[model samples]
Target chain A: MRALCWHGKNDIRYEQVPDPVIEHPRDAIVRVTSCAICGSDLHLYDGFMPGMKSGDIMGHEFMGEIVDVGPGINGKVKVGDRVVVPFTIICGECEQCRRGNFSVCERTNRNKHIADKVFGHSTAGLYGYTHLTGGYPGGQAEYVRVPYADVGPVKVPNGLSDEQVLFLGDIFPTGWQAVVQCDIEPTDTVAIWGAGPVGQFCVRSAILLGAQQVICIDRLPERLAMAEAGGAIPINFEKESVVERLNDLTNGKGPQKCIDAVGLEAHATATIDSMYDRAKQAMMLETDRPHVLREMIYVCRPAGTISVPGVYGGLLDKVPFGMVMNKGLTIRTGQTHVNRWTEDLLGLIEEGQIDPSFVITHRVPLERGPEMYQTFRDKHDGCIKVVLQP
Target chain B: MQNAYGNHSGSSRAHGVARGLGWFSIALGVAEVAAPRALTRALGMDGQESLVRAYGLREIATGSAILRSENPAPWVWGRVAGDALDLATLGAGYRNQNPQQQRNLGLALAAVAGVTAADVWCARALSNGAGQQARLPMRDYRDRSGFPRPPAEMRGAARHLSIPRDMRAPEALQPYRAG
Candidate 1:
């Protein structure tokens, strides 16, 4: 089988590798119909996130048709089931999973010792991620082995194309969860950072959840245009002061809810704070660049909620704890509990409430993966998202 | 399925040392690819960006082979040869006058040497199966939590065969009995 394997920073290859088989009774083999390259995969591609091994499969956003299943899967799934597998692997029986915290399931992270030291506890097994999560092979290949098949794979209807339902595997759920944390009221105003694919989804989700106004911030014109298409007021931080622009747009009051969709690898202009972060990072003084976190706090209204869907792998330095305490801000974040909302989100897609394939800027064969990684990372060719067909 | 689920069932995905070297190759490869000019200049080999990029590709290729190959021994060997080539190229920079940079290069050389040793060790283990097959964990499919719905759901919109098998368990064989 051919799969996209991570070798190092800025280096990914589509290579021939062994076919996967059922190791557990509940395992099922899915012939991946479509897979997506996520922003989080960039965190791994850029070598910013640690714990990834060489040859680890790369990608989390994918959907496929089940071709084989172990008897352990019993009735949950069988041969020929078309399904969307969530990125987070879970045994529904675990205490955390039972509580609907599928991303932090206790039994999934077999490589618990390293994660225990880094994060103080283990996260649920994530397909194709680093060793911090269980290092399961990702779906960026012809076929992939999915564990806990009955619990995590959502069966999809035939009327929808793979692209339409593919993101149900990760980003849509993540964006929804970010806003759900804010508890937005119909009259509330929302501010979102990064108008990338996830940010576009958040813009729609915020509006769908009843926020009166949604503002998206980014410098890229295409992504800003995408946010505009999604009904968000676009703010170009490169052209104007973000906090001032957001405040002015909201009549001197900051947004009631702020969401940071950009995670660890946020690029900044030549500002003093950004310069400091760049210098500190190059010198190994800090691991994450938390410019968005600070900006989110600065533009958030007093007593409002700050929701982060962005991936932060390690400790962040010099966060404004004083402002958070003084303003009584509520900050909520987690890896998306994908299994918890699979049914609800699937229903949304079924009703034609959303068409996630809108953000797809490029679709190509898996062979183009290596070159496309460079193109997507460079943000060239109006490439907001790239979906690979294997 | 003989070598399924990472060399063998129930074993750690890959040997730790091999995975570590794979990571090392990637880190160094990323540095080379991201800013070849800057990296070559800093290494006192100014005006050699193309050379650095080529090396970056090689590093990435070998690193990928180590990670994805079912028999990673040959790929690990490629890394060993690549390491020697790197040292041979850097031999000129060892004579540079900047003691700080010189010390840094020396530390890099030592690190590479350590990684090369581990690569050799892992290559040997891959040849030996690392005792993985002997300890393969057998699967007991019935221990599963079972499906969330009937088997028909698995078929999606596909036409179903009439009179499919019933999912009910036999009365005497059922694990749980009603009170």
Candidate 2:
């Protein structure tokens, strides 16, 4: 099988690797049909996410067909089924899964180092990255093994196109989880802190779930315009004060719900101190630092709910505890339980209530994945989402 | 399938009750450890039927294990009674673990039994041919062609997918020609 492997920083290659097969009774082997480069992948490409080594397979967002299923994987799914695999592979009967906390399942990629060596776990038991996830190969290949198929892969509805259902694997559910965490009421106002794909999904989901008004903050004109098209009022932070603009729009009261879709690499204008730079410094000290999270606390309404769906390293620095304490806000943050909502989100897509394919702005062959990584990292040419077909 | 146990009805119910009690104890234990005040208040009710309900659930769970043994079915009634007693005794152990969890366990156990009962009834209905299986309304993708191959015009060149105009519809729908 040919796969795009990450050898080191800025070094990705499309090379041949052994074909993946059903290694476990609960596993299913999927023929990669369509896969995309995620914003998180850029971290691995830049050598920022620790514990990554040579020859790691490099993708997590994908939809595919089940070519073969292990003996134990039956009833819930079968051969010849088209499915979207969740980023987190969990044994549905495990202790963590029983409690609905599938991300930290004891069985899947529990030992970061060992798992990485085998499957490439840069962050968890993720497919196609270094050891943070267990280094199981990624979907950016001709074929890949899907662990815990019943709990991890969702069957794509019969009528929807693959492009339309692709993001349901990660980004769509992630954005939806961000909104769900916010606990937004029908009449409440929302302010999202990014205009990227996840942020745009948050905007669209907020409106669909009945937020009276949604404000999106970002520096990119293209992304801001996209947010506007999604029915959110865009705030160009480079041209205006986000806090001030949000206040003005909300009649001196801040939005009731705020989400930080922009994670560690969040940008800042020349006026305000850059949280990204500060986070990098904190990372050096091995401290608990939350730069954008602090800003979120400052901009949110008193007693408002804040959801942090943006991915972050285990360690952080310079957290603003006083402001969060004084604000009386409720904070919910984590990886999305994608398995819980894939079917429901697919239903919404079928009804035409949401069309996330609107965010996809590039489609390339599997071999061009490395160049696409560079383009996305540089944020060049208004790239929002990139899909690579095998 | 005939079971080694004569009858499983009484034991299954007992097991359900025990499992419910175990969950209850765990919840109460959690609550006791985390929020002692809440735990005391919740357990303050007259005769503590909530606590009894929790115990019943634990017995039901224990009954499942018993029913799985030889002569599973007929032994259910005896196992249920035994499980209830065992749960009451185990509740104290929960206190030693985490008071907060104890309280949470109590609350959780009560809820679990109710849900478990509902699950058992549903399972029975489906098993008895009393319910019809509904075909899932799945999306059709059989005729779908593979993703577009990389255009020959842009071979080796990084070409981005064009953002739909309706998504933003540039001030005028002018085509965004690549430089």
Candidate 3:
């Protein structure tokens, strides 16, 4: 099977690997039809998250047809069943999965010992992510061995194109969960940082969930414009002050809910704290940049909520915990429990309320995944999302 | 708005040069700090060791600023100014220098001249925005909202959706409430 493999920092290759087989009784072999380069994948591409081995397959957002299933799967999933595999690999029967906290599912991470040492407790296993999660070969290939196949792959009904259902495996539900965790009220103004794909979804999700006003912040003109189209007031942080503009929009009060979709790789170049982070990062003194996190803590309304759908790894320097404490902020953050919201989001897609395909700015063959990684990382050619046809 | 680095290569290359220069600055500064006596002895400026160390501190500060700052133009310009001061100090030592000392001073002056040229060039490139500034796009995307209807009508369209109890904010923080 041809797959995208991780070599080192900033190096992804399209190479041939052995085909996958049913590894366990509950496992399934999926022949990938479509995949995407996600923002979090950039974290791995940039070599931020550790534990990735050489030649490890690289992808998480993908959907395809099942070619084979283990005997334990029984008839729940059969061959030729089209499905979108959620990024998180879940055992379905774990306590966390039972509680709908699938991102923290107790039983899926094969690397639980390593994760326990690093994270105090292991979270759910994820595809094509680092070994800290399950080092499961991801869906970026022609075929992938899904460890907990029956639990994670949501069956896609016929008539829905791969584009419409693809993101249900990740970004669509991720954005949805980011907003749902905000618990938005009708009169609340929601401020989201980062206008990337997840951020775009955050805008649409916030609106659909009934926030009174949605503000999307980014330095990119095209992304901000897209956010505007999605019923969000676009704030180009490079042009005007985010703090002042957000305050002006909210009548001198800060936004009631803030979402940091930018995560570890925030690019607030003009700010002193970002400079500090870059300096520390270059010196290997800091692991992640928390510029958006700092700004959110500073600007969120007192007693408001801060929901982070962004991926952050390792230590952050100089976070303003004082502001968070004094303001009485509620910070909710995690990897998305994708399965918990896939059904609702699938209904939304089926109802014609929103189209996840709108986020895909570029589509290409799986072979071009390496170049697409650079194009997407650099945000060249107005590339918001790149969907790969494997 | 037009970004100075239209194609992005120039900006990326400029940042690469700026980073190289930053590391160079720190390396040169460290050399001076650790062995000011060696530099002074070579130049025959026996009493100027302390001054050499002071300039080394300046170099370290400037280098740190360049490496740490997103914009390195001003810091590069600072390097140019520091180069000028170094030349002036070396030239002032020329009056009392012996033949061997003059040769070493001349060599020192040429080395400073070379670095000074790089500093000036890097500074000008950065100031003109031909260097490491972000390349903002001219592509318009105001129409790419993912909604089926106009956003105004679609606002709160998913209100029928339920918010899980654990996910909801405390009652006091809810803006719209039930009687």
lDDT of 3: 0.89
Report how far residue B131 has shifted in candidate 1, in Å. 60
Which stretch of 10 consecutive residues in model 1 chain A shows the poorest summed lDDT? A268-277
A232 Cα displacement, candidate 3 (Å): 1.3
After superposing all C-alphas onto the true structure, candidate 2 shows an RMSD in angstroms of: 25.8
Q: Which scores greater on TM-score, model 2 or model 3?
A: 3
Q: Over 4 Å off in model 2, which ranges?
A: A110-124, A268-272, A275-283, A286-290, B1-179
lDDT digits (tens) for residues A168-285 of candidate 1: 9999888877876776565778899998788887877776676778889988777887777666788988778998998898899899889999987777322446545655776689
Q: Report the C-alpha displacement of residue B129, candidate 3, in angstroms.
A: 11
The sequence of per-residue lDDT tens digits that candidate 2 reaches over residues A45-109 is 87667767687788999888999989997667888999998888777776767766666666777
lDDT of 2 at A70: 91
Task: Give the least accurate 10-residue stretch of model 3 chain A, judged by summed lDDT.
Answer: A267-276
TM for every model, in the order presented, reads 0.70, 0.65, 0.87
Encode model 3's per-residue lDDT on A156-270: one tens digit a residue. Answer: 8998999999999999999989999999888889999999999999999999988899999998788988899899999988789999999999999999999999999998345
C-alpha-based local distance difference test score of model 2: 0.67
Of 1 and 2, which scores higher on DockQ? 1
Isolated chain A TM-score, each model: 0.98, 0.92, 0.99
- The single-chain TM-score for chain B of candidate 3 is 0.70
Please compute DockQ, using alpha carbons, for every candidate against the native two-chain complex. Answer: 0.02, 0.01, 0.45
Which candidate gets the maximum TM-score versus the true structure? Answer: 3
The true-versus-predicted C-alpha distance at residue B34 of model 3, in Å, is: 13
